[model samples]
Target: MKLPLSADPPAFEIRYGITEEAARRKGYEIRKRTAPPDPSPLDALLKKMSPEAVKKWGETLGGPGGKEAPNVSVTMPNGDEVGAPTTGCDAEARTALWGSVEHWLLGQRFGSDFREGLISRAEKDPAMRALNVEWSQCMAAKSFADLESPAKAMDLAASFYEKGDETTAFTREVDLAIADAQCENDTDYVRKRRILEDRYLAAGMGGYETEIAATRELNRGALVRARTLLAS
Candidate 1:
């Protein structure tokens, strides 16, 4: 069947490295702040004892008799459940501290829904329906007759998560995905759908331009903040 109009990699996928780098930096900061230092056993023992008794006992024993212990738990800033001292900082606190960077990363990935809507509109066109019929026949010839649309195939791919060994399921998904791509290419389904989608998008360029421009500016502002944070 015909592939969805937005099956190609997203525009933001090109800049995804920025999100990866920022996430790593954020994780480092959280770990640095929340992972408590290890404590000596003597200090740990002494804190549980009264100071006077410990001091008197230390003299009797010929040395300080206690060591510091690691903290048991850390209360996060957002008042969520306390995290173990060995864990990373609070998720809410990290978001608050680096909100601008996160916002930009999200803005870069906002157009998928818009593209999907365009695809839906394109599918309603008489020409697209005929192309879809051809695409279905092509898929049937390849022994995937049960799949009526690329979206349905995608859903089937996702269904692999429900059961079976994960690696085996993933291998099955790879095979299906490759077949889907090849079938779409062979049938020229992708090319025809792309032409229709472009025409639809061009027909309503005004609203699209405004939405895209706003999203672009949001990403630009966020990227600037993310760069500053990383440099610091």
Candidate 2:
């Protein structure tokens, strides 16, 4: 599979410091992603296959195992070795964008650390805590009580699976998701959350300035390469 460049920024970037309207728009987009359809018969059959059986089936079908890309490894800034090998169009696309699989892997590691730090800081912020209480109350009024934060709403929805059939569980989940979105809108949850996240992110970014700059440069170069590859 070939990875396509997204017009939108990464979710972490959108959550961290985007404008209130942008944040709300992103929240709406997230809420619209409902549960997937029921699994098909083919999917059910695949679930019954052992890992060894799956591997043998793939081999019979000429899967990547027989012509795997050369394994590549790189030492991260933290001195940990990272190894990831890709095959086919995915490998080719990644090579065009990052020069090697190692570079893409390094970017992923840095991005993960960057996202984790920002999220941790925002979640613990005093202002954010106050906002969550307001949002929770809004949700409670809609009969979805005891929601700690908007993030926890999905977990609550998923819990329906333990008590009911898939169809019923999915319906309840969708209802909860709709209520969650409404509560967020009524309480200005996304706007307030974004403001707090922006404050925390601004303060935190100073510590990761070098990493951020390198990531930006990597993305800019990748965009140019992506366009060139597409044209070719």
Candidate 3:
């Protein structure tokens, strides 16, 4: 099987001094952006894919017979078991490059702790809470009541898809998304949240500097190896 290689640097290797700095830059970018007029092409295509088509695409990557791919189970620090598929050329390439899929999965699971902490702290921040209240009120005015956050708005949209005609669900979801974007824009929610998030993220990263540095070093090495592999 042939695997596609990307020329761009691995996202893991692209850091801006620290997590907080990266978050600040991202927040700035978000403040300068506007919502798109329509669903992204990937989203549109995913919504249009039939079950049979999805299965066929899976088979193309996972070999013939359309059987479900094998899964590798990783037990998290919380003792929860998460299963990730170990199939397709991409998975094979990752396993070859990383040495062990289980190790990579475990790293991913634990590596998110800093981000989770940052988000948790940010959400509880006074400024972020005040912004959420304002955004919720804006959403309420748009008839999408009780939306505490953008995540909640997304959950509400996802609920429509769970038990209705897909086309109708998609339309309703789009309308809700548009309303959400409007509310967020009116409240300047993204920028405000990002500011708070960056503050918390930077503060939180102080405790994880060693881990973050180690991860970045590993990522840099992996990128070098990947480039060598691709060049050959």
Per-prediction TM-score: 0.44, 0.57, 0.53
Model 1: lDDT equals: 0.51
lDDT of each: 0.51, 0.64, 0.61
Clashes of 2: 0
Q: Can you tell me which runs of candidate 1 are displaced by over 4 Å? A: 1-109, 141-143, 154-186
Off by over 4 Å in 2: 1-83, 86-93, 108-113, 141-143, 165-171, 174-182, 226-232
lDDT of 3 by residue, 50-109 (tens): 867766665555433323556667654334565555666546766666555554555555
lDDT of 2 by residue, 1-232 (tens): 2122221213543322223354333432332345576799966776798877765554433224522534566654435565654544555667779876656766666665555567677888888888889878988888989889866876676577777686676667667667777777777778788777788778767876887788778777888888988899
lDDT per residue as tens, model 1, 91-115: 2323334353233223534455455
TM-score winner among the candidates?
2
lDDT for position 200 in model 2: 71
Clashing pairs in 1: 42-66, 42-67, 43-66, 43-67, 43-68, 44-67, 44-68
| TM-score (C-alpha, index-matched) for candidate 2 | 0.57
Ranking by lDDT: 2, 3, 1
Candidate 2 to native Cα RMSD, angstroms = 7.7
| Count of backbone clashes, every candidate in sequence | 7, 0, 0
